[model samples]
Target: MAQTGIADRAARNGHAADEGGAGLAGRLLGGLARQVQQRIPAADLDERDPDYIRESLPRQWLLASLWFRGEVRGLGNIPESGPVLLVGNHSGGNMTPDTIVFTLAFYTYFGVERPFYQLAHNLVVSFPQLSFLRKFGTVAASPENSAKALQAGAALLVYPGGDRRSLARGLGLDRLFRLKVLPISLALPWGINVGDFLGHIPLPAKITVEALPPIDLREEFGQQPDLDEVYDHVMRLMQDTLDALAAERRLPVLG
Candidate 1:
């Protein structure tokens, strides 16, 4: 009789615990739904519009062909149909012209309908003037967002260094200096000295953007991956490519 009572008590406790866990999960899901609803419906760009991209192709073509004179290598490295992470070193300050060049080139080569997304800073997506970025499938950078994109069989472009880090490293400026002056220059109402502009006009820099071989995290790192090792590997690959490109350039803007 005592054993039966003890077992009954244990079962009751286990049932209570299950109920508590379900309640907590329900609350979390409810809160997540509310947060999603609160977000601006128009601003919630979870996908890309191929039609919009198609319409904008001409302008991108002009920029890639004439303005930046950008060249993309290693197109063959990208898998024909699968999730890919196009990691590259960003350049051209707050306004990453290299990103634009690469995006245009990628779409032109692959066509707009193919699932492709570029991860960018939250500020870029939130800015009023840059709303057009959403149309081009530029999503705010986040681990969750990236995972979702990959799961959906989309090719994702990510600059691991991000805006400040990439700009500082690419331009060879101290990270502290870039952080301090970048905001000041951006916030300046005068519009005379925008840090990103480089000068009154963008110096006609012959930017060469390269696409390194795609990395399948599952294949390379296995089920249990060491992220630090993966990060180091990717960085080394980009650094090597950048060194090669730098060597090819005869002059600063005239490369």
Candidate 2:
């Protein structure tokens, strides 16, 4: 009888362990699903409407041109056709006016009919109310989406990853894809538009964006160049341009 009871107890514990494991797995999967839902909504592409962009240009232009007194130079430097990658600095902390100014300049110059897309942070794209962004070809930033846009021969705008990563991609991707990497520089409002993310009154601070000459990576850095060497070259080139822009600024901080 004692032996039989011990065996029964052992079987019951084993059964409970299985149930506990299943329960734990269910919780983990449930948590992961929720995170996925909150972070990466299954909406990478397929919402861009040329008509919507055309209709919206007037409003965006008004804000960019009138309020910010924005100026974008070197739009013509961008190739008139084909897949082009625009990589620029995110100068404004929460209120990235450079993006708006550049977008307006691109659309007005190229016309809304040409396909142009920008990769946005997941936090920005996940909001349901910001669905209008999708209409403007603003998709969640991902390698897959970037590749898809480029492969489709669309003008894709991407912010560099990080210090080292940014340099690596700025050149590496260009060499791999045979792209002309356009580096952008911007000077935007300071005080009034400081809290750009939360919404603040812009001071008409005269935002200026300059698109530097497109760098053909393989042509400039050679077909097989060291990433670190390429990075240093690009950094010096951008920093010099930034310094020049600052020197030309009338309202150094505000603009």
**Lowest-lDDT window of 10 residues in candidate 1?**
183-192
> Candidate 1 lDDT, tens digit per residue, 1-255?
643443344445452222466655544455454455345233234557889899988877786668667777766667766666666656635777677777877888888888888888776778888888888888876655665666676777766565434432322222222121111100000001114523455556776766655565546765554555655665666667777777787764567
lDDT by candidate, in order shown? 0.60, 0.65
Q: For model 2, how big is the CA root-mean-square deviation?
A: 10.1
For every model shown, the clashing-pair count is: 0, 0
TM-score of 1: 0.67
Report the C-alpha lDDT of model 2 over 120-227, residue by residue, as the tens digit.
Answer: 778677677677878888877665577677767788887664666664653245444443333322222222246655556445677767776776666676776567
Q: Cα miss at 198, model 2 (Å)?
A: 2.8
Q: Report the CA-based lDDT of candidate 1 relative to the real structure.
A: 0.60
Q: Pick the candidate with the highest TM-score.
A: 2
